[model samples]
Target: MKALLPTGDPREPVVLADVPEPTPRPDEALVKVEAFSVNRGETFKLEAPAPGDRPGKDVAGLVVQPAADGSGPNGIARVVGHPMAGGWAEYAAVPTDALAVLPDGVSALQAAALPLAGLTALRLLRTAGPVLGRRVLLTGASGGVGHYVTELAAAAGAEVTAVTRDAERGARLIELGAAAVVHDLADAPGPYDLVLESTGGPSLATALAKTARRGTLIWFGQASRRPATLDFFAFFDGPESAVIRHFHYLDADTSLGDDLAALVRLTAGGRLHPEIGRIADWADTATVLTDLRERRIRGKAVLTLA
Candidate 1:
């Protein structure tokens, strides 16, 4: 089997090389990866990768071998999975609990896009509580997770305000159900009941300031690769009842398989859209990683196994 590995070189950080096929445990299924998605966070680890560190999280494929424990999908089922690592390969050993059977009408490309970004958006909205008739602020609203957040939040009856520097992306966000689109954080209307913030740096402080009284701000990512410093005294004039919470998708209490299955069902039903920005053969994994690191691609980038 062939897998993408980190080369530890500044110019060429990743290379596709032949590797041994993975063996599944009793609680795991051996998947023949039809497609996979790359994420921004995964690209950061390639900067200084450890020995034998496999870089991939979102995997979608057919279960060639089911788990011996009789959990998850049965033999030869189409499924999407969230493995801790090593999903950028022709074959992956995915734990049954992390695997979700995909329904008809869901393509592998769409399924591949769902695991990480979809799960993060779903979990963040869950953390945001009921959003009906609420003013929701979404920062960095052009990427994969942001797309899902905008669509799902709007479907739940929340008035979504999407903030993105890209005018084209801003236009698409409105089509995806955002009530309003702003090019800058300063331009976004304040007093938001819930703020889903991912861009770090100064945007974090701005998002914090925009949170309404007794509202919630969920900080999920630092895509800007910069640190955010908040003026302690600034909060004195801000809403004292507002809450700021750091969130990671893995911290959610629900079953991973269940959450993924729900996302797949929504996609199958055409209620949820998995915005795939780029698609290419698995041989071009390095190029895809470069595009993701350089921020040339929007939404999710999916790689297919030829």
Candidate 2:
């Protein structure tokens, strides 16, 4: 099977190569991958190795063979989490418990883009508390996770305000259900019940300031490549409250199948829609990684196995 491997060198870590096919264990299913998407973690792993590791996490495909334990449903599965070693490949073996059946009306490419970003958005929204009739703010509203967050919040009856630097993308944000869109945090009206912060650095502080009193602020990503630092005094003295929380999609109690099921349902019912940036052949994995690293693409970039 052909796979993309990380070489541990920042400049040239991701490369396409022929690798041995994965063997499914008793509790795992062997999926003939149809599509997979890239995430920031994958890009970071390639740029800087944490001890020993490979990239690629999200996967959507058809199950060629079910686990010996028969854990998957109807012999079809969507795998996520654990950053399996062969996502950018022709086939991958994933735990049957970690797989979910793709929803009706959702394409393989779209299903591949949902696992990571959708789960993260769901978790963040849950952390933000009840959204009924509340105002929510979303930074990086044009990114993969942001789009899901925007739609979910709106569907929950929250008035969503999306922040984006690009006016063109801002329109798309509003179309996704945001009540309003702004070029920056400064331009957005404040006192939001919840703030979904995706970009770090200055945007984190900006999000904190706009949060309503006792509001929750969930910081999920640092796409700016800078650490978040805020003044404690300002945070404590402000009328709007703040809570900084990180969204880790792979927590021990998080069931991949359950999350994927929820996402699949939403997509199947037309409640959640993923905005895919580009779709390329699996062999072009390196090019996709490069585009992600350089921030040249928006939404999700997926690779479909030919």
Candidate 3:
């Protein structure tokens, strides 16, 4: 099997090489990977390559074999899965819990874009509790997770204020459901009832200060890669009762299959739109990774297996 492996080289971090095929466990299904999505976090991992580490986490494909436990979809069904690694290959062994059958009308490219970003947005919204008629602030509103968060929050009746430096991407967010778009975090309206902060650095401080009293602000990622420094005194000036919560998608209360099914249903019903910013052959994975790392690509990037 041909797989993209970490080369541990600065100039060529990942190289496609012949690797041994994966053997599925009793509870796992062997998927013939048709497509996969690139994530920003995976780009960071490529910075320090490991010999056998397969970096891909999101994959969509045909289930060639069912789990021996007789769980999950069967009979060569189209499915999307969240594998820990080894997805950027010809096949991957996906755990039954992390797999969901893709419904009719949902293309492989769209399903490939759903797992990480879609699940993250869905779970974060779950953590946000009821959003109806609330003021929501979403920073870094142009990436894969950002697009889902913007649409989901806005659809739930929250007046979403999406912050992104790119005006072009901001315009798309409005179409997705964002009520207002700001070029910077400082420009965002204050006292938001719910906040999703991804870009770290000063943005984190601004998000904290703008959170409404008793409001919840979930900090997920640091796309900026800069560490955030906060003055303990600054908290005193902001809302005294504001809550700062750290969120990870894997820590969600719901099962991955359940959440993925929800997302699939939304996509099938023409509700949740999977924003695919880039689509290309899997051979172009290296270039796509560079584009994502430099923030050149918006939304999710999917690569198809040839």
TM-score of decoy 3: 0.98
Model 3, which residues run further than 4 Å from truth?
none
Q: In model 1, where do residues sit more than 4 Å from their true spots? A: none
* RMSD (CA, angstroms), candidate 3: 1.0
C-alpha TM-score for every candidate:
0.98, 0.92, 0.98
Better of 2 and 3 by TM-score: 3
Query: What tens-digit string does per-residue lDDT give for candidate 3 at 84-162?
Result: 9999999999999999999779999999999999999999999889999999999998999999998898899999999
Which tens-of-lDDT digit does each residue in 49-135 have in candidate 1?
Answer: 999898888999999999999987878999999999999999999999999998779999999999999999999999889999999
The global C-alpha lDDT for each of the candidates, from Candidate 1 onward, is 0.91, 0.78, 0.91
Q: Write the per-residue lDDT of candidate 2 for residues 133-155, one digit (tens) a residue.
A: 99888888877888898889888
State which candidate has the highest lDDT: 1
Report how far off residue 274 is in candidate 2 (Å): 1.3
Error of 3 at 222 (Å): 0.6
lDDT of 2: 0.78
